[model samples]
Target: MTSTPSANLFKPLEAGDPAVVGGYRLAAVLGTGGMGKVYLTYTPGGRPIALKVIRPEFSEDLEFRRRFQREVQSAQRVQGLYTAPVIDSDTEGSQPWLATAYVPGPSLGHAVAQHGALPLRSVLLLSVGVAEALHVIHGAGIVHRDLKPANVLLASDGPRVIDFGIARAADTTALTGTGVSVGTPSFMAPEQASAGTVSPATDIFALGQIAAYAAIGSPAYGEGSSHAVLYRIVHEDPDLSRVPAELLPLVTRCLTRDPAGRPSLTEIIELCHEISPVPLRQGEDWLPQAVAGSITERLRLPEPAKTPPPLPTVAPTPTQYAPQQPQTPPPTQFSPQHPAPGGVNPYAPTGFSQAAAPTQSAPGIPGPVPPPGHPMQPTPPPGYATRPTPQPGYHTPPPVVHAPYTGPQQPKKKRTGLIVAASVVGAIVVLGVIGSLLPDGSGKDDESKSPSGGGSSASSTGGGSGDGEASGTDAGKKRPDPKPASYQGIDVTENYLVMLAGDPPRPEEGDPIYGGGDLSYYVDSMFGDTWIGTDNGKFILLNNSQKGSLETCRTETRYTEKITLDQLSAGTEFCVLSDAGHIAVATYKGKGGAKESTYVTFDLTVWRNAEEAKEED
Candidate 1:
């Protein structure tokens, strides 16, 4: 069966969001709230359901998952006419989600806002239905921790309680984890507002708040800030002026300050039945005509589109490794490896003849030509200077800046005492190299490119034999320290660190005091996750995330211009932002004048003139 439309609450799927969860086809988004997003979907058996996918941040939290899983188990046991039962779930996936029978109705909060206070008769039915659902939920050992107007659905038959996403076992201590409280403070129970232990009575207190809202189209406690509403809930009595006199007794009892003083759901239900104009039943029409008609329209609304198809997985040529048999030599020990004279990785893997290399390469990616006809050996990609080749005893070095690319190059290191004379090709036999290089699929352009100004004189000698002989003594030497050009006296870190731009292009040995670069390098690099600022001489990392706009380098990063990286070292503490997906550092001279500050502004203007390109290829 097709799912229903979300009444303007549905949003089109975004990039990176999944089209299917487990097996259900997600058609349209129902809504998005605090925990994650809810989608309109259907089971294979044609059962319509609302599926909620946990957000990335919440999925990554181990503690939250535990509580969610436990709460889901309890929610499944809740069976009530006023509650949407949990039908399916996957709490162990990379991102968790739960599916429940669809309740195609607007929230009580929405209904009240759109059509004013529900009639006293409807409110009485709403009160009775929710109280009964709570009875079932509490009996199943679950407490609806975040019960507010938004969580209460105004179904034609009665009100349905939903969004048990944060519900937890009534008996569990420290509901989720330390230092985290989840609930809408405006409608939260007094104990919850004070961060006290939550129980079934806690839900009862919140129920009273929702009932109050449904009666007056506003909160019973004065509508101000959250703190104000919560203060009134705890310290003062609710303003019963707007509430019809009939609901005052039941509402007041539920809003009692003491959890023990509040009447049980059974007691509230009996009182509601006494006052309800019509007998409450499973199919009772408790909602007014306008409100019930809205629900009817929602259920009949057609889903505008079909579920999207799954995205295709395209495999790039370079990362395809050909299978091979293990080579058996004199079982020689492995030794340290070095790059060829021009800083080329002799062991770079070549792509299969069937696939041609793409012209646009990621940073540090090298195009290696295979030898005439020898067995394959492990080869590093063009721009990847830090991935350790799976060969024993030899250490891989950084990518080289060289001219005149040549045939498949072998690693510059060797086994201490093993040299096979197996069938050979052009002047040499390929060693234990594998077929194809499997670089990460991310579009990293680390190919060896010379910095704009001029090549720096700074260079280090890689330790290895001048001839093709394997020297175990020199092989064990640590690969020449990572390029010390990013920071003074320290090697540039692999993976996390990337030097966006700086005064010298490379770092100095003593300190970065006088060495700095244009602040606009951040704009040039388009690495929107970090921000760097300099005051006097010492450079500090700024909180990029708080920078207000994502176009700025400091959009989502923790370090802000106000914070200093004085306590952090480049490699050990933070790394450069390279194709290897590591930390990166950008530096420039003290406030480098206005020339560097306006870097991003200049780049945006270049976009219009892109039609005036030098080469199309």
Candidate 2:
């Protein structure tokens, strides 16, 4: 198992390592921890896999075996980036073992240790991806008890939370031994250190620590002996002075000793997204220069063959070893310092450590190599987020599972990468009013009463098709022109679209239109795909507000009541409010309540330019 496979992160297997596990040939060592040893292996099809063989002590225990089986089953259900998904397992065997998708990226600890504090933007993107992964992980009912930086793999896609060895289903019993704490001291939550009930919040606390470490290049709690660090985590306030100011509040909130006081994963995503929502595009480098170089070194291994012998199952063998999904690496180079189009350099240059890392150059790496004379002020190759510069050295998506929200999901027919601008964060924001977009900023006074704040109203959130609220977008023959067009009080262009939150209601009145309704929009787009954005509350417009008068429309105004669409969030009902204060549950016509925008799956209801949009009945 010492053939030097996998990217730079994996090493030659030791003498004690097994040559094969469950029919998959072990190639090298990925990592080792107190829980078990992780080896790099490949499926019969040549797809890389990380095989973790549990120690005899843990596997021999009947209770541990059952727990491992259940945990692995639970881990298999988890498909998001928070933790690598389980590909296969053999808990019933003498020594329980599990295999997962292999990520050719460095751990956060190694990246930070080699390069110093990560750039502010990288930290923000890291937060978004990790938080979203946590959201999905929790949704799967699994709590990753061990979520330290070492457990976080920096893939070409984004940060991937891995190593579910210590993870347990929230409904399971604690696996505590006599005075045993099953976690890294510096990153453990106070409750975990004190042997209290471990919950999702424990992971939140560790996330704060990860953030602090990535930002400060050291533990948030001053480092010392294991006991001292554990004590500090349990008793002392974290030293966040070194943390960046923009991230201070959220980071502080995550570190709150009281689990109840800490912000929920939802809040953390919202807040961190407000600071930096979009992360690196697939194949876009997010690690420091030295670390990216290491990743390149690792990717030198050839991809797992299309079809390898299947894991020992009573059933037939798989023709291809790779995951069913197509993970073609982008034709780009590796230059974390400069991102290609549709991308950005998430790494910050603050306190950049220049220590020479042990890692070597990857084959055909898209990295920034210094020129003959001048310093390495290299321009990154065009990536998905930006225009595609199909050059050498660019990272492709490895088999490793990444944060749920991470990865490059391009818009239909567009190959561009995505870049979620940091400047946009507010979940709901009102761009400048467009006189033409809204029939009239000041609607007919008699018909327009402030929007109804009453109980019976409708709102459109993330994903929904019910009650004809906001239907999906129809890629009708109509394509938004790049030229700015005034549509419904927003400046519209091919690059950005303007969306509105229906008019508000006046006091004591139910919604005059459709009783009462709320409006929200979300633009999940890739590069060259126009997106209706929100940087938290950065860009906002009050409901029923006047053309230039913020005082005019004073009905039901609440920016927090907004929803971006997603497939799982369908059936949520919402009314579309108009400037005239008319509420609409759905833009349906007949008794069946047929809907428009049947093909659309985002928050776009109206077009600012009348020429392009034909409002159909």
Candidate 3:
């Protein structure tokens, strides 16, 4: 068979280069690496995708090809909003490649290198986005294995995880090559450095280092050679002083040396929200779009009617697969000439059939009964079967297997007979050794055990009760009863609630409370909605939509006397009114000591209108 043309291999057809291998028309070179080159490619249609072609030398290695196939399967398992979905793959082709949805943006590393440190807002967004990705990846039982700045992209909409070529499943058979390590050294965990093992915690540690790098524009362990960085990861604590104080607790949790101690991805997402300006919402419309004109320019090509056919399957080589199980051992038979002594015998006749005899009983349970064909043989009369005579420094032979025989079985046998026998032997040995160490109690007098003052048992019990009562009385005198109804200065109305600085306010359940923060911050709402104050002093506005889903709005405003609901303005810009009649806004006012109010306005008309609409539908 003749080999394919070299010029046609992974060459772009759209750039005045001839179409190569199988009708694929590569548009632009995306990136090149030691293993392969990634190219921006398109079908006959205008749809664009990123295609990676494996290097020729790497393709020759069957083991590498198998791993690549497994990677494709693992990558395909990731299904979430933040992950770039895997579209197709050609694992068996001359140059195996996988295609994923083309995400438009600079790699995080490139973004940081060009733009310097990201602002706090962007970092928060990145943290939440990446955490979401890891959550999905981990849920699928796979580790990204190489989570680094280069593998993370700052896309227009949000952060996206890319390059899962080396991802491994928790239960997968793939093993790291001896003396070989994967992942960038700067971000690897100590366990990863020592080639110990990788797990979800490994990703958490890596994320902590990444967060530290993002915060300070430097690695948490500082700049150094690969070896030095690896050493620090294995032996040193990460420097997290530059991390924002608010986020320090979360970062510390993630940087724990023990994998079991790391906080989960969900916890990291919550931490990001704690420091973010935008409260996480399900349908927030702030998703950034791809950079203007970038996707269109990159995907320039005629749209094909359909995706290319999958490549033919290749038979895996012998060395590429793991050995099958159920390994069988050589069979051996019992030797009758073996000697038995001291009630101990390795070849003792266990009450089991020949077929089941080889299998040992579970650690503590007795062996199963022998099959009907294999009955227990009677024990030989004492001295009939000669016990081996002891020889100086000579090892004795093992016990012989007895022939099967039918006989009356022993009923009601005690399960702990062996244990009792061993215990009795141990007790006799202990008593002989300790018999002289303790004094005899024969001289003790029964009268000496009586109370010094002669008294009946009933009298003694009565005295104890009196003493107990006296101690209880003294303890009660030392501590006063707590005051009832601690909150005295707050007020609650049907529509709102107010908390005074002097005392915390208490509201009965179902009461619409407001006024922890800027109560005057006006937000437009659908008709028939209500707002309530939360224990955190923020207001939660609820729209009584038919669906019964509540839209929550958190405000930064603090409750103060100076602010009022009437002073706030209503407009489309500062409010979000759901079709079911819910609206909310976040507002804050005044510095320290200044009382701020969060004003929430409910529109009964909008809710009524939504109800009418639903009725019409």
Candidate 4:
């Protein structure tokens, strides 16, 4: 999938994220929310799962952790065709996390936003599936207080309910202080809106809102400020005019201010079945074409990279020695070995017994007699005398030298001690050079690069011995770090930490501070005004915009001299293509600088260039 399209859906894992949670290895970050982040992981059996880790701020709460543990136990008992079942969880661990069977599909909210409202028939089918899920949930004494379009995933089989019971666990926490409700404002029941009491009926009210959302493109209470919507929900009647006539009556009953007046899940399911032509189980064609395509793409996610294989083990072989013959000399005792000059290891059998050198007799001289325990000495050939045994404290006479004989000779074993020693030394030297040349690959090139410039000094070393090879590698050792695709909420100044575009589009003084090149963006007027300019690229200012608009730089042409700090009070965001050719986003984030007294600040996030990103992918 393209990063631009699913940019909001999936993200690469960030630093400090645990690679393994419990026993499941995290594959990627699914999405983040106010509570915590959800990740895509797999079970030991290779089944895909969605793991939701509780944020540290909440996990630190002893009360929240205890309630969370109870909720997890209850949620596990909820088994239904239309619910994403909880498969595993760890509530007592350092970081509590819950894992559920992954549902591969777009959420109801995303589907409605991407492909308008669902048709009448599809809405009925969705109602039936969601009602059945709620019936199962309530039967287990669990209430999905937080049920909305975002929590319902439209799977190929049917709609699947998620995030059940998690809201109830947080119901008594600091999040629900006094008048605050645990559920969403747009779909909360009247009682929940006022924080009086919450029950299974609250979910029925949310169910009505979800159906209306699917049939109509927007929430029934209408979208705006949360307080206004909650007030309307509590006192005012819902606007079901846009809702189809067939779904209007049920939606109205479910949205009743009095939860006692709402119909039970069974009745809702029966009513939906009366309208649906096909059984809810046969929902192969339930979703719209556009939504189905997105679901298919999610189901076809590529497998995660596999781990490296373990090292091999060598089995010992049995040692076998040829039977010693009478003519062969006996083996000698092992002696202490000295290393060769240049610190090389001398030739020595790794596991085998050492053999002794054979004795060679002089041409015409008689051979020395054996020790007393040996067999009788051999008779001297013809009239030659046998060597006499040496007396105590007396040394034996040396054998006499003679002229060389011209005759056939036996082959002698080749001496390979020196050759083996040289080979071992060369291998060690090569490994050392290779290790020195290997790049650290940490991607901190901008700070780690040699201050003298590039690697001119290092590369000047000529190649010959091991040192030359190591020096030659230094030139490439300063590999440019991966250019940052984007930065977030970085505080920058004009002189010290000016915004610059390069490998990392972070807040740092570069050409702008050195009086060399133009600045991408700089603070001025003592936190009152900000200047915007690029060396060769363009910038587009959004008067009243959301952060999402900064995802891509607009193609239309326009430029403003500067934006006053007061004009950006409505969260104005600007998109600029840096001279480095990467798209960057900047948002006014109040007046305060890192070091300067009262300077303008902008939260910046830069993305890699489209072509460069594609090439790297």
Could you tell me how far off, in angstroms, the CA of residue 372 lies in candidate 3 after the best superposition?
Answer: 61
TM of each candidate vs. truth: 0.48, 0.47, 0.43, 0.49
Please give the TM-score that candidate 4 achieves against the real structure.
Answer: 0.49
**lDDT per residue, candidate 3, 330-405, as tens digits?**
3211111211121112122211111212222355543332222223322322213434444633432234489798
> How many clashes in each candidate?
66, 87, 35, 6
Clashing pairs for predicted structure model 4, backbone only: 485-606, 485-607, 485-608, 486-606, 487-605, 487-606
Q: Give the alpha carbon lDDT tens digit for every residue of 1-617 in model 4.
A: 43232545566678867665554556788887656788887654466789888877667666678789999999999989999998777777667788888998988988999998999888988888899899999999998988998899999999999989887766544333223334678878887765446899999999999999999999999989876887688778989899988887789989888989999988998888776666655467877788888887786553553662222222212221223333332321111221112221112211112232223245554333333223322232221245476674343334459979978788888779988999999999999999876766765443345446355443343222223243433566433322335445555555333334454444555422112222334443333334444423345776553443433454535664333455555356777654344566666666564554444556666544422321111
Candidate 1, residues 305-375: lDDT per residue as tens digits? Answer: 34333322333355333433433323211101211122221122211111223233456653442232323
Candidate 4: which stretches are off by over 4 Å? 1-8, 177-182, 277-281, 308-617
- RMSD for all candidates, in order, please: 22.9, 26.3, 27.6, 27.3
Best candidate, TM-score: 4
Whole-model lDDT per candidate: 0.54, 0.54, 0.50, 0.64
Q: Candidate 1 — which residues are off by over 4 angstroms?
A: 1-7, 165-181, 281-284, 301-617
Q: How far is candidate 4 from the true structure (C-alpha RMSD, Å)?
A: 27.3
Candidate 3 TM-score, C-alpha based: 0.43
User: Which number leads on lDDT?
Assistant: 4
For model 3, the run of ten residues with the poorest summed lDDT: 608-617
Report residue 360 deviation for candidate 4 (angstroms): 48
lDDT agreement of model 4 with the native: 0.64
Between candidates 2 and 4, the lDDT winner: 4
